[model samples]
Target: MSRLSDMLRTQRFDDYRFYHQSTINQTLHLISAIIFLGCYALLFTDAAIAGIVGWLAMLTRQTGHFFFEPNGYDAVNDVSNDYKEAVKVGYNQTRKIILLLVWGSAPVALYVYPTLFGLFDPPTDRFDFVRHVGTLWLAIGIGGGLARMLQLFATRDLTTGLVWAFKVLTDPFHNIALYWKSPLKLLRGELIDSSIADADWGADEVEEAPHLT
Candidate 1:
């Protein structure tokens, strides 16, 4: 348990220092985190509503990674993009691309097969179609998470896999706590985050840590 807690902190810290260089990206993550917290609250009362809102938060968070975050030589972390992606315990760029592709194609699949491979009923109207999409996306979201967790258990250790899953599930609350001041920093004209000085990423335990690149 103690080891899992430590691993979670290391993952979170690495994620923060590496991916969150842009104040804009951090700010967007902050917004997503808030929405996700609300989504979590609604999960007990209404799962469909939770799923839709959760997807929205997921979209916002991924938009920051896909668009706002930099993709170049990371002087801050002194590691190549390839190196970081290789050692990432969670979804790296390659995995993310595949996930995003599936997410993008989901609507088209629903449109062509209204029953959605027998998972959902045929939509009666456009609203129903959209609802079906949402329902499918919800399943995708949950499946993606579980798939990654299992993958980690295979490639890494069971503890690492479980910790990573815990980190992802609690990310909203954690991100909000970590990045609540990002907007204020942006308003103060800080575009990029300051460089970390000689921060050891525990490369012995975790293979690599990638910065905003």
Candidate 2:
């Protein structure tokens, strides 16, 4: 009982709380979910329209990762009081943005076919448009979904990853479907310490940046 209390009281965890999914960010998630669902529906009805919405949603949804961001430093108050600490935070922020642009943007290009919205229609007679649409969504849901599963590594929380996969499997776009370490890490400034030196103390406990989730 005492150990459990100690664990609960540990300073590593914070008193931080988050609003329900009705909040603006969560609402955006809902909007993205609806769009993806609609895209799926349309993908079957007409490949051209489905491609347009899919690509558009892919662009808009992913682009927002940069526009709607809160510096994560606030989640963990800095006690370092060292001059270098603030500088480190500044450097980290810039790095995070760059990473979001590069590694995180792969899906945008990978799914560009859907994004193009049938600008260059794959010949209907030769190409099975419905097959293409289904393939794209399935790829995003399963293939990209697996990649997103890898992202749980950024959280360093295995259980959290499992739960996240279970929740977002049906809705890929809304889920961020990649382990976006930079954005979430920058938001919270929490990252896994991989230095061999730190391992001497003990294998670090699996930690998560809850705020980003």
Model 1 accuracy (lDDT, Cα): 0.80
Candidate 2 accuracy as lDDT: 0.40
Cα TM-score per model: 0.89, 0.37
As for candidate 1, its clashing pairs are 71-213
lDDT of each: 0.80, 0.40
Clashing pairs in 2: 52-117, 55-115, 72-187, 72-188, 151-179
Error of 2 at 90 (Å): 24
Of candidate 2, the 10-residue stretch with the lowest lDDT total is: 13-22
lDDT, candidate 2, 1-88, per-residue tens: 5543332322112211111111223334445656777777886777555655665555454443344423333322332223222323
Residues 1-213 of candidate 1: C-alpha lDDT, one tens digit per residue: 767767888888777766778888999999999999988898788676777888899889888888888778777878766766676777877898898888889999988888977888777888888777777777888899999998888877788789989999999889888788889988999888764334454653343543321
Q: Using alpha carbons, what is the TM-score of model 2?
A: 0.37
Model 1 error, position 49 (Å): 3.0
